[model samples]
Target: MANPKRYTDDCALGPFSTKSQKTLSYIFSPTLWTPLLFLLMAAPPSPSSVSAELRTSGEEAVPTEVIGTLGGFMTLPLNISVGTEIEHVAWNGPQKTLALASPAGAVIILDKSYQSRLSISSQSYSLNISKLTPKDEGLYRAQINRKNSNITIEERFVLHIYEQLQKPRVTVKHTMSESTSCNLTLVCSVERAEKSVLYSWTWVDTHSFKSFESSTLTISWMPCDPDVAYTCTAKNPVSQSTSSPIHAQQFCADLRASRGRTVGETVVGTLGESVTLSLTVPVSRDIEKVVWMFNTSIISKDWREPAIAGPLMKSKEPGKDRVWVSDQDYTLKISQLKMEDTGPYNAYLCLNTPRLTSTQHFTLRVYRRLKKPEITWIPGPSDDSICRVTLMCSVEDSGDDVTYRWTFLQKGAVASQEGSLLNVSWRSSEYHPNFTCTAMNPISNSSWQFLSGNICPGPSRSMKHWIILFLITVVLLCFGFSGWCIWKQKRQCSAPAFNSSQVEAPADLSGQDASSSEERQFIHSVLLCTETPTGGTTTATE
Candidate 1:
């Protein structure tokens, strides 16, 4: 409904057609002053005039702040109204003109300093400077002109360039402790810093996952809280950097409190027996809750209500049916204790009067009763007068803590020794010749008696007597055989002489030969008894 010609003319001015210009001149020539007035009103104001007016209105040509890092890129923003027609754009800096763009959109470098370093965005007419240095930090101005109009708009930017922030180094100053709390001081610093840098401290509570921040921090370490970690950050206009985290636990090594104290008790019982782990809370405070733990697992919990007269006990698995806690003193009793139960048992008590907690740690040791020991003698040199023996005392399936003790009774005197093996030299005596060996442990003890006679028995007395009798019989038999041999030799020598005389007698004499033979035999026996005649000088009384 409105005339399009007036709308186009009010927004922008472009090259007019020849017919339009001739028609405008003929109409305006009727009044010579009208042509000049129309020309004057159609032209816009000059750039210098517009700039002066903007300055008089207290308008800022440049941005108030711009951040840039050293050796990095930075952009100066420029804003233009929509549907504005631009004829030329120019960028200027402190010492020289930077760039120029013509109405045809051709950009030309005007300064050698920014020949390759300047860029302009077609969308927003923003100027980008690459590889910025500290020397490039200054105010930059952008100027733009409308087509066929003398009016110009200007924008300015103030760039501040700085080096990237370096990582901060954190150091612990010192640690001091008061009566109930500990105070720690720490310092954070950066090397070769030229710009204004801010230091901030941040810490995280590991237990709660909550975070806190401050310019500086001093910790008041408490006994009940877990470890805390803190980090330091150094930030500048250009960049931000963080240091390595440090923990408060590292500084409070010796200040930590003990959780509980250990009380070692040796409980000795026979196999297949029940043992009670006794615990008594002091009468100074009223017991509100009691808990029993085996190793690290909770085995039993006992609690009493405000109006109840007895405590309600709850037992967990693995020890549910076999464990019992007394209501009076809260002592734990284990039925049929096993070897696997030989570990640490803890009892925790909560009191109501002063609201205090007490923990008692018990190192329970369950042992099996020792069986009767056996005493055996190791063989050694022995004689009739004295005997040396080595006796070994031992028990089957015994623990390493068992000890061996030896007791000997010799010649009305008692001597004892403690070891696994005992060496003894025994002499014949009228007193009981025996010794006792005992194997003992904390749980139980057993002893065995060893008879010295059996331990080192001399050669049997009966055996010695039989050996002597056998030797005497052998000697008698040898002597008798020698006498019989001598007598037989003498008989042989005499009888041969008599036979020789008979052999020298005649070959024939039958009837009257008896007296002759007897006479000859008698004569021969006489000759033999005497001596043989020398050279046959027989007394022949013929």
Candidate 2:
């Protein structure tokens, strides 16, 4: 076992009590003095003082201290002998040769070939162990056989060695998140690394971009356009690493639009017929989006993704000064027009200006056809008489303008003025004929009545006389009855014959009878004359 004392411990003097000192003195008094005398007798002549000498070994050597005494004065010798043997050994002149053994049992020969006079007795010694490596890790033993005394000592040395770690590596990759429009993340990591690592991140921060750093390297980013270089560097105490060039890219979605067009007014046809509606709109200039709508409902809006055969065709190009657009005007041909279709129609135009748009409206009208009139004869005394007969004419709804004409289809064959009724008097024409009245307008016309029905014959001479006689008799009877009634009323109220005494007329009974007979004879002759007819035909003009 090596010495248990630590290198940092302080060297202490030996513990000695008075009683133990006396015992040690008695033991060493005579018998031990002989060995001491021998040691002294064999000792070389001592010099005044010895200078310090450094030992030649490698850096593995340890510090050493030597002591020597001489000539009863205890002077350290300058010239001395040092070797593995601490017994009686002699030194020749000034030159010194020291022999020692390493802890690993190797013989080492140390020669002091050059020297002057060694003076200092106590030499503070250190070995040059820097050139000596760890494989010589053992005690090195050295002894000094000096002129005064002999001594030997050994030193133990321990060696340690170490090696540094290697540098780390960095790998970078780019990725994005759910929000595609957001900034991307550039993640850099130390791949297959053995040591603890650190990282830093930097990006091309233009007007809109930024950068950050993490342990190895992780990065969160935002949207910014950059035209400069973005670089990332990773470093350790051992080595530094940089990344390869990364190219950044971007993309966006295409813009979509709606077609701007409108349908206009319609033309109303008559009942049970169709009407044509013309839609008016300007053309499309560029590659336009077309959406077809009815009222507010969207019929079809995607012209690019047409459900049927493509609904949108190319419009005329806008060349030079002339402006060209798609044919947005459409004529809607409506079949089977109804009465309800006559009111109004609207066309909505969604045109594309720079920003603002426009719309339009229109109207339609329908009307009914006119109907002809009807005429009927009023039955009266003239129904069968040869005199004029009245006929009534009326028209159905003929709007504002209706023309009426009464035509005598008989021998007259003349058209009369327009009225509700027309009178025709029968005359002894060459032949009997038919009469008709026509009611006409621009749209339509119709005859009032045909004369195809039974005809009314003219009155005979006998019939005329009978009529006159009947009239005369009716007048006479009426007058007589009136006179009788007056006379009876007077008689009932007062005297029967007015008490004939009051009425004194010229006794004229026979005169009155004669006047009455004369008047009766005159009426009879007038009646007979009226009954006889003249030979020539006579037509009354009124």
Candidate 3:
């Protein structure tokens, strides 16, 4: 049996208080250095100065910090030195004992609540739990000891649980009122407001993009670099997601668009349909990275050059198998699309040969299939041989952004207009017998045909009235034109000419001439329409 004396103890401890004695006691009692060893099992941490200090002092381990995703699995690593044999180990979670290992190298799970989820490794004594929940988050501890030894070695961990981070949005706008300025203000945000999220911005530059450690970034446009692309990443304790790369090549040139959403390609897709975000450019040997990103996640990427293998389809989001990128052209294709798949999608390209970068941005819109359209027509009264009817077109389930168009089915038919209402006008002979109205949206269209004879039968009933109207108008215009010509003829003959000189002529010829010339022609002598002389009832013969 070894003596239980150590310089660390108070009255009960018996030992030489010198440096050698204290060192020997610390070396034997594994509990004294357990904290220092616990840190090694944790996930890698940010760079810190304490690493060197801990190395030199060799006193304590850092508190183990483990982050587990919700509904995921995590293993609390049991970091042990080489050749250290464990007789048995016990695992404890927030509430009570989770599991234990028998000296015979068998795992025995305790806590009935975690019976289905908890498992312990017989050799290393590591604790693993699956399908983690919020209640699983808290402190966890493991105690181990060798056979016939009083010293107990232990490790502690603080477990943090977080759900997947939401997709982030990046809004771009000009900070200045002047439309000419290229200065831009970009803001990055997630759909849900979370406190523990870390945001970083990686933008396209002459070389590989340099990342900024903030949610917002301001930039001064330099004329030399005409095109610039930016991508934002949001990270939680468990996972990280990147935003779609927004190509801002036009943000400076098209100042009018700088104040609203950034300019990018917009694509319309129907729900459950497939769409391919095509990358038209060929892959160059000097290609640095070809990344396909959704709203806040990278669905796929091709990072390897000649040395690297084929494109690694690494997507952590749900329904990841539905997304794929082509090795030949780096085109991204998505199948069985859902609502969450609708967002900004980017195809980012970087080439190291000339130190250049380019990106294509696409905004995907998903819509349900359009419903069937209905056409209703109201016939108006015909006047002066003109037929008029108003046809209103409507869709049953359409809400907004719906457009309407009208087409004439009748050959050589000229009657057609667009809107919710279609105005139809035709002469008695020129009526459009068949017309179709179509209701459409971005994704789908439905058309309804309107047969004029079937819908509006009033054309036959009103046809006689139009024919009579046409005859009456023609008779009145002819009467007016004839009266004007007759009045002008009478005015020219009403003036009489007198000659005072006597003349000699034969008796027979003279009478014939006098009767022919003296009997003046009269157009309407009974009612000399509207002309009255100054003297009353005076008649003169010439």
Candidate 4:
């Protein structure tokens, strides 16, 4: 006999016996069948088999939804392997069949609705639809047939087309008065929005950016910063759009409080010095509490009690040890003043009888002390009618805020000038000169002096002395030259000039006295004849 067909739950054929009727009855017994039924009922359904069963049923399978922007391309993915022996492929749309392919691989378009806009990829069997419109949003089915087989694989896709989102608009809903603290509400909305569109709010500050999911945001405190920006964004799965940045200054302009009136004196402090900031409230109001603040930090707070009590002082990290509150007036005293301490300080006094507050603002300025200035003369000295001297005054290790002033003293007359450089002139015997350069800042001042007699002595007198000495030296040289010339003439006269044709012999002093006198006269005559036409010699002498 033919072997009984194997029995399976999925098979629709009649059950076949694996053994004799007696064994089948034993297996079907209550005790055995009950446990089997319980186990079968407890077991989870296989995903693959359930999906296959769903597909095999005539009921339409759920399609995968794809979102796409209008006027854009949409891709419908089909995960199916095209066998080598594929006979034909067909795609069905909501209204009619879209495309069909023959066994010879020639594709034909049955519906000309998307004639040029539809394309198919043979590798992935995915459908590409271009230039999508709102009308294109519908169910699309793809069917693939095997060669000489009745079995066909199918896939369904659901398309959702949407237009690009426009820019959103932000509006302020409510704003309170600027005189008091109040909440501010803002609303963000779009002209047109899809069902899936979501709204988000973003708060942008100088330091950070924060995001919120709600369309409306309420701020408890009035925003004082001009650099902060608020924006709204509308987004969907397919498109996203952002609203224009709204500055806090623009939206919260009416909510800003007026600047507090300045009531205390301006406090000036030197760098690394200690300074006290004081505030006094009017006696008309009952002082219930007092608070002192520096920048954004609280320095002290005093709450009203049954009797007089000291203020509770608090300090932040940087100013902890350096700052404290005094017990007398609740004034704030800061030691070791730093550059960061130069700002506005506030004192708040709360009154109980009238329920009013009085605020005093103090402007604190910290300055560095000026160093001693130095005066130096620039090179290029002049001694024409008046002596012009250029002096540069400067201070070492001085800040940019320091200014220089020059005080010129001439014969007890003082002339003041302000600058880093000074140009002064004086004539001979005109004035005794002295200069003092002062370097000053808001907090301190220092000076340096220069004596003209010490730095630049009497130039005219010195020049005169030099000229006189030069003239004396020239005269001495001329005298020495003249004397030397005269001596040379005398020496020449002592020697006798003889003609080449006549030879002269030496004469004895005792026997030839007359001859010697005659010879001397001849020599003197020769020397006189040898004198130049310039008359350098007045007379000839032996």
TM-score leader:
4
Score residue 267 of candidate 4 by CA lDDT: 86
Q: Which segments of model 4 are wrong by more than 4 Å? A: 1-155, 158-197, 200-264, 281-330, 350-355, 377-383, 396-409, 412-416, 419-421, 429-432, 453-459, 462-542
CA lDDT of every candidate: 0.63, 0.38, 0.63, 0.64
Instruction: Give the 10-residue window scoring lowest on summed lDDT in candidate 2.
Output: 250-259
Model 4 / residue 527 / CA error / Å? 43
lDDT per residue (tens digit) for residues 1-542 in model 3: 11112222111111112322344466447785786467645744433324422322335434477778888998888765445556777787877777778657788777888889988776667788899998999777666655654345556676777878878898887644442235788899887645578999987577765989999988876322435678899987667888888655345434532233434878777777888878767445466566554533444354543211112233446445666667666777777766666666656565668766566777777776778888888887767556678889888767556899988755543355667887777655554477778888888898888778754334344678989999999999999999998898777545421111111122224335444333333322322432468534424322
Residue 17's lDDT in candidate 3? 20
Stretches of candidate 3 exceeding 4 Å from the true structure = 1-62, 79-88, 105-108, 145-151, 162-167, 173-176, 190-197, 205-209, 220-225, 235-240, 249-542
Looking at model 1, how many pairs of residues clash? 1
- Candidate 2 lDDT over residue span 99-151, tens digit each: 33333334343444312222222232223232222232222222333233322
Q: How far off is residue 56 in model 3, in Å? A: 22
Give one digit per residue, the lDDT tens place, for model 1 in 323-399.
Answer: 66677778777766667666666566767677666777677677778899988777678677566667788899886
What lDDT would candidate 1 get against the real structure? 0.63
Clashing pairs in 3: 35-61, 36-60, 36-61, 242-296
- Model 4, 358-434: lDDT tens digits are 77778788888877788888634656545666788888767647888877647633333547887776764465588
Clashes of each: 1, 18, 4, 0
